[model samples]
Target: MRTATVSIGVSNRHVHLSPKHLEMLFGKDYSLAEVKDLGQPGQFAAQETVSLVGPKGIVEGVRVLGPIRKSTQVEISRTDSFRLGIKAPVKESGDLAGTPGCMLVGPAGTVSLSEGVIIAVRHIHMSPKEAKQLGYKDCDRVSVLVEGERELCFHSVIVRVHPDFRLEMHIDTDEANASMLATGDQVKILGRTQDALDLVG
Candidate 1:
């Protein structure tokens, strides 16, 4: 069986703003300032931060990821959703059709989104060559073996393949904490469903 080791990327709550929303939140024609580069190519953590206002409470200083997207999306953990009183569905990124929305407060203005909040599913980002080498394709779902004090297998991890993607598995803070995983930690890719079952057996 084809196997490979991938690095972990622990994702915290972040927001991806559309150009229009970016302008509204920051100012007209404003651009995001790159504070740090992320694992993925051409993605960075912006210097700006915003507060999310929900029915129950407010979460402040949520980092903004760059560059801008076609639509604004808010990615939070299930625990954060509970704290904010929003019933956000677990979905892949960019699948924000009927998810919950919240009030976003920025230094210049506020945006009341009608919909665009989700708890992002776990995924792995890899280049096409890497995916081929590991016998994986884009959109394929597989299980991963993480070793530590909280050793466990992560199932249904979606594979994302692109020319520019770096080899890294992205998991939310909740998942990371549950598995006692940190960024740069290594995990074993156990191929498809049956392969994972075989390993467990």
Candidate 2:
């Protein structure tokens, strides 16, 4: 078994609202801030709270992504949009080419997507000693079986073996739920032809 852990990044966000919707939410005075890389056209500055006015119902507190286009997004809830004022329930950020997502948990919710939030999933960083021992190659689909008070098997996890990558597995909240897991908890790795033997990290 490989003695390493992997971590993955996962986030959920809504699509940016259109111009018409922007006019409805933030009055037409606001404009979109031009961003680079994954920034989609019509991407606007979200002022924290807005309404998602969908045909079905509305989701309140919808973060209005400025510079509205055709598809507007309501990030939080299928219900929030309905009770408040929104169009769709929950539109995935993937619908838009360049919009991103971030959530702040404490008392007041004030947070934005990180610089790399929109790009790809976060992975475990490794070192040469770690990689050679684990027999992991970049882009390898590796499955890890977790045994704790409860037993689970996580399958098809991507093993990113890099010279600089440290041994660890990355999982998101959603993925954690699938295995009923927790951080710092240990899992058993089963497979591969690598020969570095270490029972613990």
lDDT of 2 by residue, 11-96 (tens): 22333555554444445554544432222222344554543343355434434445455554335433333443333322223343
The global C-alpha lDDT for each of the candidates, from Candidate 1 onward, is: 0.94, 0.44
Best by TM-score: 1
Best by lDDT: 1
lDDT string for model 1 (1-201, tens) is: 387899999999999999999988999989999999999989999999999999998999999999999999999999999899999999999999989999999999999999999999999998988988888899999899998798999988999999989899999999999999999999998888666777768
Give the lDDT of residue 94 in candidate 2: 38
In Å, residue 152's CA in model 1 sits off its true spot by 0.5
Report the error of model 1 at residue 104, Å: 0.4
Q: Can you give the TM-score per candidate against the true fold?
A: 0.97, 0.40
Off by over 4 Å in 1: 198-201
Q: Every model's Cα RMSD, please?
A: 1.2, 11.0
